[model samples]
Target: MARRTTDINDIAFGVIRVRMRLHFMLTPKGDRQAVKYFVIGHPRNGTTTLHKLFVANGLNSFHDSRDWQTGRHDAFSDFGQLRPVAGYDRTYPNARFILNFRPLRHYLNSIATHHQKVFSVQNFINEAYRRAEYFAWALDYFKGRDDFIAVNIEAPGAVRAVADFWGFAVKEPPEGLINNVSTRPKLEQNSANIETALAALDLVEEAGRGCLVSRLNGARQTALLAARDTIRCVQ
Candidate 1:
């Protein structure tokens, strides 16, 4: 003989099921806007700086390394990563891409300086030289795609060019390019050594041949001259 009574467990389970259904129904619409664009570039490039600019302009941009590490797929309007994440293009077919670069010499200098403690000098040199090949690969992989834009962050009016590409006016252009290693101490020796090594390998010329840097038109061309001038001033 058992006492007949309402089961509290049954009532709680029913409430949870109803809430779960509501959550799933409301999620897809929000996820649709996630990862609208990817800033595909290497470390010591301007990815972080550009991300700051995008946020300043009221766009929700995130650095994706943390997301990748935590196995989270949360959405954001923009995503910046040090290197291309495999399968992202196939997964996000409609997402746009920004190919960002800097002069190879300067890029190497920045990398060697910033990571001097993290990597051996020989390892640093090897890694810096490899970046050119990586850049070339990325350029060829995305060639002829109207959804991508290559930008040299050191260029003048780069922020303007980015805004134009997106078809949105910025509230204000970024103050200046950020995260330079020029002022970092103990870099002078590394810079000289890296320059000599690059010249010996002709890496700079090789990088220049990459379509991303070689093919520039309209505003990008103007920006190239500005970039050269900026580099000259810095040196």
Candidate 2:
């Protein structure tokens, strides 16, 4: 009994030490030693869904929902502008960029819904353009990075898109997308913006040597799991 107790204590101590090490590695020492990952995408397109996922998993993930609703200038800027402020380069010394991609039409509809919810239809057209610009900037930024993983969902033949999107990335796709009722396609500009944003992430993933995880629906649980896995893997 004494020997078994000792063994159990040793195992507990080992687990605690591992957890401590993980916590320490996650926090950057200084600005120069920091690493930040930006989840850049136009309004909607599951950015919030991803944000919720990360938070749910107890990772240091930021989800500024106001960036989409209010005319808040923070989320209005291009990826380059938001990149430094978002501190993707400073938050983690070693980070992976998880880029989400969707169809153009479906993306636009999301934008419209966002606008309606916020009652900003008065200047809707201009806001849409601004959002598109941001997405373009994000794509350019993602493409420039070598450490990004681009996950494209709209692309057909991507049976595992939804699962991958949820951060599970199983070899086989789960059942659902086919039987699920499809929503209306997004607007042209919104679609374009999503395409541009995804393209940028693809470039970053290619350069970063990171793996892509895809899924059909961007759920909170998936984001949290992905975030936890990402932080663990990166750290």
Q: Whose lDDT is greatest here? A: 1
lDDT values for all models: 0.51, 0.38
For candidate 2, the 10 contiguous residues with the lowest summed lDDT are 69-78
Candidate 1 per-residue C-alpha lDDT over 37-107 given as tens digits, one digit per residue, 9 for 90 to 100: 66766656667666666766666666643323211332232223333333446545566677677676666
lDDT measured at residue 8 in model 1 versus the true structure, 0 to 100: 46
TM-score of each: 0.61, 0.38
TM-score of 1: 0.61
Local accuracy of candidate 2 as per-residue lDDT tens digits, 30-115: 44433334455443545544444444434455555322211111111112223332344344445445555454435444555444
